[model samples]
Target: MGTKGMDQISEKKRGKNKLKSKKKAEDVVDDIAMDDKSDTKHGKNKLKSKKQEAEEHEEQLKRLKETQAEFFEYMKEHDEDLLKFDAAEFEDDADVEAETDLEDNEKQDVDVAKKVNEQKTITAAMVDSWCKLIKEDAKLGAVRSILRAYRTACHYGDDTGDDPSAKFSVMSSSVFNKIMIFVLSEMDGILRKLLRLPATGGMKDTIMELTNTRPWKNYNHLVKSYLGNSLHVLNQMTDQGMISFTLRRLKHSSVFLSAFPSLLRKYIKVALHFWGTGSSSISVVSLLFLRDLCIRLGTDCVDDCIKGMYKAYVLNCQFVNAVKLQHISFLGNCFIELLGTDISASYQHAFVFIRQLAMILREALNTKTKEAFRKVYQWKFIHCLELWTGAVCSYSSQSELRPVAYPLAQIISGVARLVPTARYIPLRLRCVSMLNRIAASTGTFIPVSMLLMDMLDMKELNRPPTGGVGKGVDLRTLLKVSKPAVKTRAFQEACVYSVVEELVEHLTQWSYSVAFFELSSIPTLRLRSFYKSTKAERFRKEMKQLISQIEANSEFVNKKRACVGFQPNEPAAASFLEDEKKAGESPLSQYAMIIRQRAKQRNESLVESDVIVGEDSAVFGKNAPSSDEEEDEADRNEKGAAAFSSSWLPGSDSKEKEAEEEEEKKKPKKRKRKSQAEKKQVEEGAGEDDVVEDFVFSSDEEDDLFDIEGDKDEEDDVDDDAADEIAEPETKKTSKKTKGTYKTWHKNYKKTKNKKKARVA
Candidate 1:
């Protein structure tokens, strides 16, 4: 029976081992499948460790599940553009009914699809939100396959005699499946083939000549016609639904243009060439597509775009060709858009791109596009300035910009100087917004903000200021300026708002004014417009707080600037203050003690100013002098200062300011002043509390006993100087000046000056 049981136990163990091995085998299979699915053609994830793969897998799954509901809701909420092309395509009277019925059926199907998606997460529904979708999912892949299959079937299959449901399915599937085909067209994809495309002998010869030599030889008719056709092709392609959709769709993919760098380079080469030579509408549309892509993809598209800038063949010998330069300014404008993207590229790339951008912009500012003294030039300069500021902020690190910071600043500052006098106020406001962004990024932007403030101050300097915005224009006048156009830039253009916003932003960012800290100092920063918005009121309130906070911060920073090394103390200052109080020191002395203690702890060599009040009791003890000597010295100094009291000296200001000034003065100088150490030596024997009291100056200067001795010492020095020069040792009564008054000394020694000079020499 024992032998049988052992055999049975072995059998059981084998069964368990087999099951564990099977489970492990299954896990391995699943991991292999995940890896296969996760692999990209670019090999971005190939170097990742197994752990990282697992982490990414888990995160992707979590994010997918999290956004699944959102995707469904987004499908339900989304409304596609009405198919007006079909409406225009169908015009026959008999076919109108069929088309209308088809359209109604399609709308009903769309609503039903939306309802179905609203209830569940379908991978097919997520394709439309392409800007955010990056990762590949098996479910989504399966859905795409299903849709493509249905679309292909509906296209080729006998349609059951034009079934409306069949039509709807074909259209819906086509819309989603078409983007997955890696779509490109001749207009967007033909850069490498441009020279190779079949052309007549003359055309081919001219194309090769222009391509090899210079951008200017395109003056020949054949070359001009070919170039014009290219421009037409570019505009047509940019406007096409498939190209626009596919270009935008690429940005959503995880690897972006990295997989298709070759294709992207081709697209850029073709686009920039057409953009340089194209008409206004053609050029604008051409760059718009590239701009939208860059803005969405940010730095992912930067390399390809930059590669095109150098190799576009639009420039000849480092300068944009004179013929092409007419509309080449749009290239600069396009780069401005690119530079504003949320750049994640390295500093080296940013530096290179910005340098290239400056070069392109220099050539592109041809005669037609020069930033002239005109209303439109303002926007042109605004674009360039914004580009530089955004590039520095988004791409370059602060430390990286430090070396080039001032030159870059001067460039932006120069543009800002032109903004105030800019003929167009709308563009001026844009300058304000750009400056606001620059201010948010660095301290270097404050000068630009100040420039705007000056412009704002001169907004109505030349023009006769209107009575106000709401005041009726005088119809009787021969030359009546419209409020919207010619009135105060503030009242007409809403110009003051941006100017004030910039000023407030810069001030709030850098140093705070006294007005900022004290609300009464700046009584108004808001317009009391009739029926104002809640935003205005809320902004005013927030502005007030912002100003106060900034001022308080500036004050705090200023206080610590001298001893910033000690500000972030190793120990919390509050604990030290508590300890000082525990040691029975006064509140005023406690703060002084904390400051000195923190200073010493920081390994800094301590000076008299850094010593705590109670640490040097003897110095302050002599400050509180004998009462009779104080009265006598006070009486003498009062007569001297009484003559000059009205003059605003450092300590003795107006009556109201004197109290505040004395408090400010006393705190810093408390440890520095010399007092008669002989009398205060006894205070060393007293308690910390007694010494703290002896040292602190009372709030009222008159009632203050601690600071009187310093004033008397200063007064005595003045008396000694005057007495030494005027008093004579010739007679006893003259030397003594019996009354011991400066007035009495002057009267006694009236003519003794010549006698004193002989003895002094």
Candidate 2:
């Protein structure tokens, strides 16, 4: 209560003062030291988290690479052994095993199988759990591992060494589902990052950067250090995921079409690399991606993807196998699938891809390359060509594909025409059917048939000429013409002989019958019917005529070779020339005779119709008679043709006259009515004698002309024989000419004498 109390009372009085309130407010407003500390802690935490993420990504990448190595090593070293493993059991109702065929060849090693199964359990479970982690962090390495595992699982059941179909099929349903999840997560993540972008980053700094192409390209390797590269993880999961992401966001594809088509292209490039490596099993996923692009941006979109795929397979990569051609072919096929139902959505893509695929197939399977790598690549080439065939046939309306279709048809035709491998009979038959399908669909049978005919005519049928030999001729042996390129002329000849036989065998089916084609349904536009359209009719007729021509040509060839075995050695050649009244016999003539016979049977009037006859049509070779006396001589020759001259082409005019008198004695005058004569000729089958005569004429000219008759006085003998025939006509003509000359001379002499007399007078 004294001074202290008075001070306490003052203090109490001071607590009520505005100055004390001001001091309290100052204590409350202490500097934000906690906030600075908290900010520092928060920044440290963020940096730590980023570092952890980066390490995780790097570890995952390393794991993926290791897994890839292990998988390959296992495949190389323990493939067949692994098949001995008992397939892991699923629930009674879960039929994963039913979906896959795992043939266990090592039945004696049950313990080994069980051990392998036990070992796989650990890895499989690890993979299953790892895929779950991948969903949150979304690393490309994890995705790639999943992809490789997926393929390995798929190919587990595959016994065929290089079958690509095995790669697409999954052996483990569990593994496939896991890989699919990983792939979709990663792909969706990338798309979201690519499309949505960071709202507060450098993207907002520049309007051009935001509206134009994504600036993501600027941060390639540097960004990959943090985000990891999709390209490096070339596997099936990435392929499927990328496709699913792009397709699901097709509503946003316009942005890709405009500002980020390269992103789409990059995805395809990565997919192709994986495909080229033969690592990805689901190649159809990549195909769908390309096809979707074509459908969305049109086939013009085909170029970017094609270029990417081409680069992936051929550029700066170690994937130059013949099998890689199939991937390129598949990419090409993807473009041809459908831009739309309309034929107008830019055929440029289809054309470009087709051309690219053709070039790839040709270059990779170049005759030399194919020969060098044939055992390795023939099947691959066959597969690629089959894909090529399918791609070409996909274009039912060939108006847009005309330029492309012909080359494709030629390629298919060449397969059969080229030295066809006997092993390739199945391939050839497939190609033939495909070609027929193309012809039917496009209504381009004429050009296609022409191409096929030309294929037969090529000097090299794909391999070699059989030189007319038929059995076991490796049709492929005939491609190279000479020396260093080919081992020997004999080898080439054998090849050629084989191919010719194959061609004849194949073309024979088409040659004699066009009725099947007439009744067959032609593939055309979806709603358009191919029933008897003008174009369709034309196509059918052309096919029939072409087939007939091929048939005729085959017959000609067979007949030519038919006598090769029994050719009249050197001596008989001479006899064939002189006594052979029907010297120019030919199968061409035989075919003509047959055709004429058929026409006569069908309708006598049609024999005069302008049909597609062979080379010996009357306009081509017939020489009309010079005058009526020659005509009468021909008539006499025809009338007496049945009566042979016993003189048998002896050398002199006296003998010819005696032979003619004898022939006249044997001849009987019997001129039938026109209709009856026509009927008789038809009944006689248009004369096999005519065929023999034509064959004798042509064969002699082609093979034995100079060989046989060089030393013989054949010309003089023929001349003397003709002179004898006209001797009677000649004597009468000469007498008349002499009388006319004498009269003229006498008149001239009289005129001169009279003139002289007059002058004298």
Candidate 3:
């Protein structure tokens, strides 16, 4: 049994060995199959990667070709405009001179010959290398090529279209921006070194004279080309940001502008366009550039600048309303400040413009035609008057602009008298306020109380307000109101309030004078008579408050006058309380401030309410009440009133303004007047808030229509000796006309004027 078991075990072991060998053979086949599959997968991956690499390489080549073609195309288009841009001109000047043996002009021509561009294509790597080279040595000959390329690139798509006016910027804005950044940031320094110009602190006159001499002509030609091209690009640009950026960046080059008169004039013209019409930020930078140019170029180009700015102002202010009023006022103030730079030069411009205004007024009066009246009644005329008035007031202490002030005041006063009726109270008040400004700035007494007092006597003030359609006349833009709305209580209230405000302002301007007691007598009496006689309780209250302030101020001045031991003719007596802080300490001024602050708060509250109502209406639907909607509706209604007024008033082009009104007239009378009560309520509220803000809340001395803030620290360097020469005749007249208090006021005013001029110097 043991032997049988051993034999069986051996057989089983042999069978097991055979099975293991077979299993090992199967495992080897499986390993071979797996290897084959892995090899196949590796081969496919390798083939795919190779194909991708080939495609990428082709793409890079194609991209490089496109870039090269684009650059070559740009060069082809603007090659003529680029100086020293051709390859043939790169020959050594000494070699050309020796080989040609040319004359002086021919050798000079060789000096400015077109330069060779080392790199034919403008690739990324090539640009980088060029930048590196420029950084290392700004005086490299390659810089001219780089600059030419930059100039051509900046205006890449501007002239590509068949119509040169159509701009199709195909190149990305990023590329253009990069070019501008590189050039603007580095070109000034590079140019200064290349032109052998000194640092910016060097005298502009020295630079101007240096640039004009024989040695600097070649450099000046290059600079002029560069600057002219830069200005041309600016002229074509419409983006406010780009214009602002260009002006700001180029401001550093103003010292060089003195050498290029035509370029300076062109730049001034471009800047004036922006200053008058661009966004606020752009306007600021544009004005800064213009100021720099004015300083650098001096008086040679100032007249043209002044005229262009005035024209710009007129053109921009054609459609003045409350929203743009402040901006317009700011522009005017800046314009006056610019004028203060070269007062002697500006005097002629001011005189010319003021004369033009006067001639227009005179023609209007003589012709008595609608077209003539239209010229005087428009926003342009009003803004022009405001502009010159500000110019006068700004330099009131300087005799150079004093002569313009009188005629400007006359034009304004004539405008006030042109339409001597209750309907044109706003225009009349505007004229009076301008007069008041001139009077205050020059410390002279002007008879503006007559204009304000005249409004109180008009039938519009005494009539009870009737129900009116839409927001009662926006007296701001209303030259005339022929609608029954003029008879409304809201209009009456606004009219009376405006009159009272102007009266107080006119009185306040002279409240510090030695003759204040005398000046207050007539105005105070007229105000008292109007105050007691007015029927409206609100108007009466306003009049009473103003009268009380005037009386109190009169008392304060009288007391100060009583304490004055010196004669009224003495200089000390005339200069009493000339300091701003001391002048602001008066009860009248304190009251004015309080009224202005309160008015400001009320205006803020009204604006917030308007905004809230606007938001709610937007959230709702068309039927919902909205402040913006109400304003639009009111605008239409006022337009209708204007159209209606134009019909009855002789010389008005009634057909034009009546277009929108014709549609409204077709509606039922009841519906036409449906919102009369609502409109009246709205107007009453708005009038209560706006009248005070318009009149009492105005912080500046320029115009009641717009509040213009002056820059007290504005540096307008004046020639003191020239100023004295100009003021000599006026000073003699003042000395002759003055006897007691008037003479004292003149002496004090003269002293203050000298100090102010000294500070400016």
Best by TM-score: 3
Instruction: Residues 1-761, candidate 3: write the lDDT tens digits.
Output: 69999999999997886576557546644764675567568768764333343344345435534655543344345453532233333335435654565477686766654221222224445456667888876546556656664655445544342232322212333444545556655667677776676645344677866865665775665666567657766765655555666676688776777776667777787888788777766776776677666766678767777888888888877664444566677677667767866999999888877788889999988987656776787778898898888878768878788877777777888999886766567788778878988888887778988888878877668655543322333455455443234555667766775666667677777778777788778877887887778777887788788878888887888887787678777888668768743748777778777766754553344332233112222121223222111223355334333322211211122354476588667775767587787788887776233221222212232122221122222223222333344667997887777666687898999999999999999
Superposed model 1: Cα runs more than 4 Å off: 1-241, 244-265, 269-304, 307-378, 398-405, 419-436, 443-445, 459-464, 467-486, 489-493, 511-761
| Alpha-carbon deviation at 444 in model 1, angstroms | 4.3
What is the per-residue lDDT of model 1 for residues 69-184, given as tens digits with 9 covering 90 to 100? Answer: 44323333542232112322333543566678789999999999886545432243443443123223323333333333323322332323234433232323233232223221
Q: Give the TM-score of each candidate.
A: 0.29, 0.29, 0.61
**Model 3 misplacement above 4 A:** 1-120, 158-175, 201-204, 212-218, 255-262, 468-474, 563-572, 576-585, 601-761
Model 2 Cα lDDT, one tens digit per residue, 211-286 = 5455545423223321222332232232343333323222222233334445556555554554444323334444
Best by lDDT: 3
Provide the clash count, candidate 3. 5
What TM-score, to 2 decimals, does candidate 2 have?
Answer: 0.29
Q: After superposition, how far is residue 742 of candidate 1 from its true place, in Å?
A: 92
Give residue 582's lDDT in candidate 1 (0 to 100): 53
